[model samples]
Target: MNLIDFLFLVFATLAVGGGLLMIFSRHPVSAAMFMIISMVSVAGLFVLLESFFLAILQVLVYAGAVMVLFLFIIMLLDVGPEGSKSSKIKLLSGLAGVVCFGILMVFSLILVLNSYPECSSCAVWPTLDDNNLVLGQSLVFSTSVKSFGFGLFSKYMLPIQVAGFLLLAAMVGVIILSKKFVREGNPS
Candidate 1:
């Protein structure tokens, strides 16, 4: 395969492997670190797709800010390694997981079989064509960013606002839950 394809494969493998490792990790800190690796790998994939802006945003928002906040929370909570599960419980869980995976594979196979290629000549929305000008003629604006902003602010504004409010509420709840109350008179 080509260099780009090989790099994409490497990044994709890292992303998926890191995600699986994060899910299976017993330690919260280890899981968070794995998640960071997954996020950074995904950012690399974005770079491969020629979306440098998205790649930078992905690293900045997810790998940097979100991961730092997650690591901080994990440290603050002083979380310990999870207790080991009974062998019987593990066996049953593994069996259930295998069954679910089989079902998902079947569905995926069916989807792949039924899928058909679209007309190659059809024009994609928010065309990446150099002719489409936005704002001024001095600089050519990226249609992806422009269309994303327009869609987010116009059509999906309400849902986005609701999600933001929900996130804010959750953050406040977490802060409240983590707050340590000290008794005024107790010196011990």
Candidate 2:
């Protein structure tokens, strides 16, 4: 309808389409590229939300740094597109995917049937200006980096820590998986 709504729809479509393409792709490189597209679209969504810091982060940290890392690893591994699977396996996987898609469609139809009720918030963040801060109402949501940092530290700390830990674990897992292990008796 409006420019913002149009942009939101575009970004949301790109994000979801890219993600699905990434998942279904057999080639690791193609999947990584699709993931970058998804990440950039997510950054666009963050921009639409008026969270510039998060948008920059989505671009820089995810689409830029992480994707580069993933691409480099994929290249180093010399990965190829997946080979054909057994027909039985393929049939079962296809059935599973269809079942999952059907479930998602049902949920989506339910939401549409209900006309998409307005969301309810557990905690309503306050609106703050300089005067509000001066009046000791510092815990408020804004488009500034300070409020963003406050939210990250106060409300979203656990998720942040969990993400960091997952990244560390992934790094460790990569090293473990890539390490060459020699047999105990044979030096060769």
Q: What is the TM-score of each candidate against the true structure?
A: 0.72, 0.72
How much does each candidate deviate from the true structure in C-alpha RMSD? 5.2, 4.8
User: Candidate 1: where is the Cα deviation over 4 Å?
Assistant: 118-127, 130-144, 179-188
| Model 1 error, position 84 (Å) | 2.2
| Candidate 1 lDDT over residue span 1-188, tens digit each | 99988999999999999999999999999999999999999999988766677898999999999999998888888989989889999999999999999999999998887885565788533444545434453334453566557656766789999999999999999889989978889955
lDDT per residue for candidate 2 within 1-188, as digits (tens), equals 99998999999999999999999999999999999999999999998877788899889999999899999989898989989989999999999999999999999999887985556863333443532312254465456787666667877899999989999999999899989999998999
Candidate 1 global CA lDDT score: 0.84
User: What TM-score quantifies how close candidate 2 is to the native fold?
Assistant: 0.72
